[model samples]
Target: MDRSANLVSFEKIRKAAALIKGAVLETPCLPAPRLSQLTGADVFVKYENMQVTGAFKERGALVKLDSLGDDEKKRGVIAVSAGNHAQGVAYHAGRLGIPATIVMPVLTPFVKISATRGYGAEVVLAGNTLAEAKAEADRLAEENNLVWVHPYDDVHVIHGQGTVAMEMLAAQPDLDVLVVPIGGGGLIAGMVTAAKAINPNVEVIGVETTLYPGMWGAFYGKEVRCEGATIAEGIAVRDIGEITTEVVKKAVDDVLLVSESSIERAINAYLTLQRTIAEGAGAAGLAALLTDPDRFAGKRVGLVLCGGNIDPRLLSKIVVRELARDGKLVSIRIDTPDRPGTLGEIATVIGDMQGNVVDVEHHRLFLNVPAKGATLDVSFEAFDRPHGERIVAALRDRGFVVRYLEIGDRMD
Candidate 1:
């Protein structure tokens, strides 16, 4: 499909910026010293996760809602999303006294589904993927005379999303490039227009998870595989928006792909260094920087942490997995005589070595263990990798058969 550039302009974006002034939070675009250290670039991070709905989707959703005719508002609005966009539309629609219906995938996260409904939008769980949910949403909109508020494809949505760039440049005028995550391309498309319009020399780059490289594939005019269980599900879009693709091609300087592990590292970095929570898609920009540090070294690169809607369970898993990978957390199985004093003696050794045991499992009756021996699997927290090694060495000096277990090996 040939996409037309110039479908959105700076003036419309400025108007959107004005319209959403008091309605949306003017999210901070501040220097990230820790991220700068990690990425080897002078990095600034935009905290769009600070928005009430914990996403940048609020800006676009509000603008689209405000643009609706009174009759349309009376008739209501409908949207399809399983994440931030659903919350954004539901939140603003409730505030504006418009009836809203959100169609989400059946497997949508419980937190998201409840949050959208709490904002007073009726949630219909239909289909299995976002594409299928959208089909249901489209049908409902046409059947009920409801305005269809598209998550990323609409002009108003793009204009509103551009407001982030306006605020970024206003706060820090000398940014060399913007590193934004691309899903259906609304955020980057809007950002590219505003950034280029303000300063033609400023570069805009889009980041996509390697699992779903829709925009990346579009740029190269080849079909790339687009399906996987990505942690960055927010940007796991298989299709690029028509209007957004046009602006992206013209204004975006580059589109890069980051691997799943890179994204996981970025999320862990955000939590540890920045003391902030970033959803997988939100951390993609930083993931790209981690993947290729020299590409952005010495440049004032801006990263948009787009959302913070990750589940607590998932966040804990990511954090613990990172700790295990870093050797701060470890699991070890020790072959021990099935004597009463054996558990106490090993636990004492670990404590004396400064290893704090968090969990333990004893397998005395397992086929792998000798009749008079038990396999004790213990999980411990160490100060660091070397400290963990010291603890292991201390246990080994005691003549106990010990083996370290990787996270994957320990998972049941």
Candidate 2:
């Protein structure tokens, strides 16, 4: 496993850039003023999420597909991906008249599975994790004589992914740091290869979800437990590619692991502060900055927003959760007499304080609550934490026992 020998060179990445030119978008790399303010860094974002398939995967998939011989193209290609890579291969293969089949994990979101199928690839749902799905893809490829289009391991794929950094540095050559998210390591490996080649002084940092610190563990030689449900499911990889590991070990400046909560906050920041949608993995770079702002403060940092194909329902939940965390949405419990006017009185106090009640639940049969009294659980919208606190104070002034409910607290 002499990975140095297999390292994707700058020349190959240049070729990939040439091959993908006109076929794929050279997405914008622009200064993010609000993000800069938040992180205390001169933040520039590469909008890879603006690609036709809503991810940077299109770059690598197209380059890989173009490298296939005519006979191989006719034989079709098979790939295993949670979502983004599947759509990339499926969409490009459709354009090239190459039949495509995608094997996806059973837990992949319905939105992604549907999008992949919509791209004209025959979709097969198999296995519970990506590793399991890859096994099924291997079997299918063997039986059907399909060419395997690996999601990240191949040299061609790595070279194509490198174009992201090439373009980023071309647009802003003075970037002090380039923060990239790692799944199987193709993206960062490629980016680091190009970034370091272009300007060795520019540090390339890799970010991974704490739950799946595959690249982090490989870089540090630590046995990390890489299993969990993370919002950044795209990078929830348990294994690192051999070539990527070698490149990261040799070239990458640092590998950082970010918590799931930080990832969620980054996603929200992208939406609220930058007016863009960033999926969990796409926001990992920003999460790294949020997790440790001082490290990047006052430096020119480039962050790759790699993908934006988040499920609508999940995005809505993230938005609501952020509002709750900011105290714009508040939940409270009140113990009061079960009399007819009790509920109206409480509602009046909230209304008088300009709090907009959204949901209310009444429980009278609880063993803890007296038989003649009931508990009112109310969720409301306020302008800010101070406003919510004011509303709570108003309730208490009226002699109602009110308790603010924290997020994830069990009402029981």
Candidate 3:
């Protein structure tokens, strides 16, 4: 079916809101005081991660599943996703007693794959990226005569995602700007439609990570390469949806491209400040706020925390890395003479300053170091940036060559 020709109207979104009301969770749309303080914008967050499948995809998946015919349901539904969409389709399809087949990239997180399988869908790992997985899904669907459940391209999915904007406006009608993340553009397309119809004056902004600017390119008519293993892998689409591109081209006010650091900062901010979990794509809207705070200053902004399907291990690393960036954690390398008490002396200075040592590494015979001297890498926890600086200062006063690893060496 050519869904590109079928544009989603506000009325269709309202109908979808009504049809999928009881089937999906009505996630909270509430004020975020800390986020507001951190970003210079009056911020409100729509918690789509509260859904059973931990994403907004549940709405679109349920609408698509429920709209299936008996024969179509019997033949099964096939979809391509590496994250939330796969789980959403698997979960709701299982609920509707429809067989579900999910094709995911081979490198897709195990947590997402397990969750989809737990919902009784047959999971297939194929290709190396979302587009390749999609190709595999198309092949499987044609072979098995399965019904296709396009994640973002179908009219039903776009309308389904629009319900989030409806619920947000119903709860907080005074929002001046709606900032939504764009992967294949469905969420922003639906949201811009609803938001513009409700308040024509309300600004609709689309956010994309710098690594994958598919929607940004589509919105601005540019041909840019979309590559990289970004932390926000959920929005790592190389191709934008035809239907969504059409809607976005007409409705979106502007698209903001945010860097990976901004996204990581946003995720950490959500975790520490809001006491919530936000995956990379889920944090894109807030990332835009962080990277370009001036643009949103004084405006009441609505941010969609689209999904929280991040792997636990990845989340832990991100949190620690953020702490390092914030100076709450410090890893410093010291060049000292090959003496036993030299390491103890540095440790004592840190301990005296009330810093807790986290890790210690000893290196000898490095070409850069003097023949008589050895290198010691010490990691410690600090209360804050000032405290970390104080620790470094104390070590410097002791006449040791101290170099901070956190600031000097950052992963790109």
Report, for every candidate in turn, its global Cα lDDT versus the true structure: 0.91, 0.93, 0.90
Better of 2 and 3 by lDDT: 2
Arrange candidates by lDDT, descending. 2, 1, 3
User: What tens-digit string does per-residue lDDT give for candidate 2 at 1-412?
Assistant: 5555355899999999999999999999999999999999999999999998899998999999999999999999999999999999999999999999999999998888999999999999998889999889999999999998888888899999999999999999999999999999999989999998999999999999989998999899888888988888789888778888888898999999999989999999999999999999999999999999999999999999999999989998999899999999999889998889998888898898899999898998879989888998999999999999999998999999999887556557
Best by lDDT: 2
Candidates sorted by TM-score, descending order?
A: 2, 1, 3
TM-score of every candidate relative to the true structure = 0.97, 0.97, 0.96
Backbone clashes in model 1: 0
What is the TM-score of candidate 1? 0.97
lDDT of 3: 0.90
Error of 3 at 160 (Å): 0.6
Window of ten residues with lowest summed lDDT in model 1 = 1-10
For 252-277, candidate 1 gives per-residue lDDT tens digits of 89999999999999999999999999
Name the candidate, 2 or 3, with the larger TM-score value: 2
